[model samples]
Target chain A: MKKKLTQFTAYFIIWLLLTWSLHFQEVMVGIVVALIATALTRDLFPDEMIKFLNPVRLLWAIFYILYLIFYIILANFDVAYRVLNPSLPIAPGIVKVKTGLKSELAKTFLANSITLTPGTLTVEVVEDNYYIHWIYISTEDPKRQKQIIIDRFEWILRRIFE
Target chain B: MSNPVAIFLITVGVIFDLLGCLGLIRLPDVYNRLQAATKSVTLGTCMILFGTFLEFGFTSGGIKALICLIFVLLTSPTAAHALARGSHISGFKLWEGSKMDKLEEDKGK
Candidate 1:
């Protein structure tokens, strides 16, 4: 019964968010038709983790979205500074770092985060470690670079999901 | 709380961020730069966000900043680690300064 309620709420809230985005007459009619279709197909699956009942978590997700916007700005500035420099000033290299995450979701989130950040690209990650490619490498001590991301980003991830 | 305190936090955060950026520019290899950028930016961002919180009080922006601060701290390193390990597994060349390519040998086995 609870699952059914959650599923219904998910469909309703999803419809609400969709309509909020597209308030056109044709779109609204299409949205209503699509929502009815979704409602009919709802019980075919058991749990999608798509329940909309967790208002706190939803708020947290929205807050995270806002956070992404701010960080992306900072990231853009860093990338621009590198691009605008007199010399092509990039010391690209591949570095390996350790991961302390205990779950796959946490690890995947971390990987996506690295990719999302402009300068550094996530090359590969396996069994609690990462192969990261950075556009530059100013430090002789590899640990210095490793610690910045590890302590800075990965630690925060520990709090949010795991 | 005070203006100086807020400024101090923001400065420190920016310094870390700058250091990270500086490291990326000066570093030799991808692995090396990833080390610098992720660490510096994440920590620096948090510090800056904390300062923003102090300035803005417990409003939506402040709360949002705090949430972002937390997110950066969490995802940045894990991403770095994944990339590094992936590169190692995928046979991307490591730096000349690297003391060990043990992962390479392990992969071979």
Candidate 2:
């Protein structure tokens, strides 16, 4: 019941932001839609959503998103440099790395972050082990590769999700 | 549009978009093409949408642009992941200069 209410409130707020109108009809419609949507998706979200309601976690999540934006810009430049270079410098290969995050959502976030950043695309995740296809094969040692790929994003995500 | 900054952003976005498309054609394998497509194209399209938002301000068009920006940010990488995983599972080989394939090693073990 509490979880459903929180979900409903979150959805309604987003609807309001997207609609950006205070008309009575609009508000009522937003309420109805938010309720139905939340009810439908109630079981989809794990208890993780409750943790997200905490203000501190929410702020960290926003900060992490900003950090991601900055990293993404740098990543784009890196990709552009490699692609446009005359030699076409690329040494593509798959490498295995392990993550400490236990939750499904956290793992998914890590994978998506890896893919969004340049040079790394997650090919598979079995247990805590992830098979990532990196455009530039930096190091073959799994320990070193884990430090290179997962360390940057996982620390922040740990605070937000774990 | 009228704003020089907006026009410049759009121009940069288009150039990156073109480069990403070129990568798709020039890259040797599916995974490589995905790398180019996801990073460059995602940045390019987001920049384009942001420029449109700047050009339109807080009007309905600007809000829509912002929504599209968020939507693209959320979805593009997931889509890329699905494609990359699909290709990998389908036994797509890495390029000739590839150094290692940990996925195969894991399966063997």
Candidate 3:
């Protein structure tokens, strides 16, 4: 009975705090809603053995975000310039790129990262391998392009999610 | 300087989005369609959402617009690629204009 009470109180406190800070017109209302919610579905987000906050992974995630933000800005400028240019200097091609991340989540993140960059699009991913269809493949050599993507974006994804 | 500019920007975005959807429908094959949709949709949605950002400022609606933009950026091509790859593996040939299917030759391992 004591253990059950402790669990309830713990959940109630967490919910109250999250509601208190993340969204609230009034602190008292937030607390009431959180408490009511806690009373209703107290076991919704059952406590996992591993806490959501893993410090090392979070640090790496921050680094990845910063890197991606910088790249996004660069890519935006690059795309805008190419669009405005009279020559239409785009070398469109379907290039297959490889990714080396071991986890599905990592692979997904890596694939998404590639697509998120303005000039490239992820065309396929079967198992661990990725096949990209790029707008301007800067290089004809598939191996070099694969290596570059894996080194830059895939590596960052592995750090962040894995 | 006015709501008309906003409407114009939104119209441009909508045009791009329509082209993207049209490409998906009209293209001869899946790979080509994926290409058309991914590029057009990314640019289209980003432009629309960016216009929203400018219009609404950094309020909840603007933040949601930003989030939607981020999601589209990260997910659309990933999904399209997954579909293309599954088609490739299951033996959906590229459009006849495609000079070669390099992947098939690389297969048989």
Q: Which numbered prediction scores highest in DockQ against the true structure?
A: 2
| A1-162 per-residue lDDT for model 3 (tens digits) | 443454556655555433434544555665566567657765553433122157787778778877875765455455544544566455544566666677656676677777656566566666866666555557777678877655778766766555
Output the better candidate (2/3) by TM-score.
2
TM per candidate = 0.49, 0.94, 0.58
TM-score for candidate 1, residues paired by index: 0.49
Docking class of 3: incorrect
Q: Per-prediction DockQ, in order?
A: 0.08, 0.75, 0.17
Q: Considering only N, C-alpha and C atoms within 3 Å, which residue pairs clash in candidate 3?
A: A123-B81, A124-B81
A3-67 in candidate 1: lDDT tens per residue?
A: 65566555555454434444577466755665576678775744534432466545655665566
- Runs in model 2 with CA error above 4 Å? none
DockQ score for candidate 1: 0.08
Better of 1 and 2 by TM-score: 2
Over B1-109, each residue of candidate 1 has an lDDT whose tens digit, in order, gives 5678778989988887787778677666667667557656776888899999888766656666776776676677666666666656666777665444434644655
Write candidate 2's Cα lDDT for B1-109 as tens digits.
6888888888999988898898888788998999998988999999999999999888778888888898898899899888888887788878888989889777767
After TM-score superposition, the amount by which residue A60's alpha carbon in candidate 2 deviates from its true location, in angstroms, is: 1.5
lDDT at residue B92 of model 2 (Cα atoms):
80
User: Residue B100 error for model 2, in Å?
Assistant: 1.1
- Identify the candidate with maximal lDDT: 2
**C-alpha positional error of residue B80 in candidate 2 after TM-score superposition, expressed in Å:** 0.9
- Fill in the DockQ of model 2: 0.75
Model 1 stretches with alpha carbons more than 4 Å out: A1-12, A19-63, A140-142, B1-109
Error of 2 at B29 (Å): 0.3
Q: What's the C-alpha lDDT at position A40 in model 3? A: 74
